[model samples]
Target: MSKTFKFFIPCDKAHIVCDKAQYREASLWEKAKLITHLAFCKICRKYTKNNTKLTDKIKESQIQCLDRKDKAAMKKDFEKALKDYSN
Candidate 1:
């Protein structure tokens, strides 16, 4: 492929671009290449659609994680239980 006409990217690269776009990390050129790839690749288009839907659902869920202190306490408890079980 010519250097100037390198807009169409492979599926793997398109997937990475899609993920980066979801996280607002992909550059404008990468986005453009991904869009061009999606224009003709049905499979990639579906993959991008599913990825977008998954991202949207995650944002809507607003999931939370345990803080560092809570995680440390949980790990300590688990270790204590394992020690007891081994004895």
Candidate 2:
């Protein structure tokens, strides 16, 4: 189609753009296209809403993670258990 009509995007592409937007990686043009798509696509709008909620929840949870030293210790223990089991 023509460049003027390029703003209209499909659901799959809109989903990708939505994800990119969530991660602050979408370009201005892509965000515009996604907005245009979301304007008419109810499914995509819901998807965007749910995705936003999930991101918000994750941020609010403030989850902690294991450091590299802790991970290495766990790996070593797991390997020892495996070796013992295989004997």
User: Please, what is the TM-score per model?
Assistant: 0.93, 0.93
Best by lDDT: 2
Among all windows of 10 consecutive residues in model 2, the one with the lowest summed lDDT is 1-10
> Following a full C-alpha superposition, what root-mean-square deviation does model 1 have from the true structure?
1.1
Q: 20-65, model 1: which lDDT tens digit per residue?
A: 9999999999998998999999999999999999989999999999
Assess each prediction's global lDDT (C-alpha) against the native.
Answer: 0.93, 0.96
Error of 2 at 2 (Å): 1.8
Tens-digit lDDT track of model 2 for 1-87: 798788799999999999999999999999999999999999999999999999999999999999999999999999999999999
Cα-based RMSD of the predictions, in order? 1.1, 1.0
